[model samples]
Target: MPSTSISTGSAAGPAPCLAVSGASGKTGWRVVEEALGRGYRVKALLRPGSEVPEGLQGAELIRLELTDQAALERALEGTVALVIATGARPSVDLAGPLKVDALAIRQQCAACRAAGVKRVVLVSSLCSGRWFHPLNLFGLILVWKRVGERWLEASGLDWTVVRPGGLKETEDDLDAQGIRYSGPDQQESNSIPRRLVARVCLEALDAPASIGRIIEVTSAAGVEPLSLEQWLARQPQPA
Candidate 1:
């Protein structure tokens, strides 16, 4: 059976139908697995060349190139929300970040619009717009990521940007590692598990307060874990 039923989530309600575009990556796979564990129906979208992550074996899979708008439209059909776990995997090609990170996001937003998929949660980096950063050495990635975020900003869609700190892998005791959620640029450094990032993405879909906002997240072992609703309630609303 699919991991999470299309009826339950971290929020204690029926899970939403989630379409994840980068279901083959380490973090992407975790999001799919976590979503399943939480009772959500997942549609795993991937490029044909992307390696198949073993954990994603049971997900409903859609294979296609990002530039193929028709395929993107087809894959997103019936998806209640789109969780953009896709990113420019580190590579030798300098243009990969721009094409995949910036332009790809624009394409997905366009397809979402065409397919009536209104709610979108983008998995972005913590330092998305900064020109100076070590991660940018991999292709000026941060700059391109910001470009992608801007595209979504202008797409006229209901969107949330989950700008996470450096990604880490850990499934143990996530509830104990409280999340520090802040408005865009409120934070500059930290790390979080891919699983938590996925949960936050699902959380944002139902949070009207999250729309049009750029939320940065990081985790701390010493901090008491806080739910998205709790974090959001305490932060200023997006203007």
Candidate 2:
């Protein structure tokens, strides 16, 4: 593993509070924990019936349906940024992906606009727009995810899309893995720990250069780890 220290180039002064939606999920909970560890006030938002994971205890929790425009806007109010970790689970219902990945994303973007939350980091998946991938068997999830990403890109908010590769649950040996970060479609298949993905989300929040970019991440032993700032500086800026 490479050195963990990477300059974030964070703006001068105190950081504002952040909101993390889908805080009860595997990756979502970790994002909340990492933000708290970094000394930022956090608001954990969840669906009305979602379980409150033990890891989310320290942060303020709000429960509401993402489809409820008014409630979603209110939950997002006063937060300077939002990290959208919401994702559809595998289900027999074929429309699940369309609703959760696409429609729900549009809802959140509308709420963000109404609530004045300008910064957003969305947890998307690699191969997000592909039509032939096997993952699309789950209701064309990748297609919907791509639709969601497009909505955010056009939302006019300061946004960065973190498209992580296959996620793993193992926390052991994390220090041995270094992240490989690149722009969209640069990498196709690999896996990364949820913890590293969570860290990148926070790092994107701190690094302004991440705005309007789609960053894909995967990790493996012997790869040099670079901070999001370091990686972004090396990419060509959008015209």
- On lDDT, the leading prediction is 2
**Tens digit of per-residue lDDT, candidate 1, span 139-236:** 88999999999999889888889999988888898878888888778788889888888888877765777788898999988876788877777876
**CA lDDT of every candidate:** 0.84, 0.90
lDDT of 2: 0.90
TM-score computed on alpha carbons, candidate 2: 0.93
**What would the TM-scores of all predictions be?**
0.90, 0.93
How many clashes does each candidate structure show, in the order listed?
8, 0
Clashing pairs in 2: none
Q: What is the per-residue lDDT of model 2 for residues 1-239, given as tens digits with 9 covering 90 to 100?
A: 11222232367656567899989999999999998888777899998899988889789999999999999999899888899999999999989999999999999999999999988999999999999999999999999999999999999888889999999998999999999998999889999999999999999887877888899999999998788888888887777
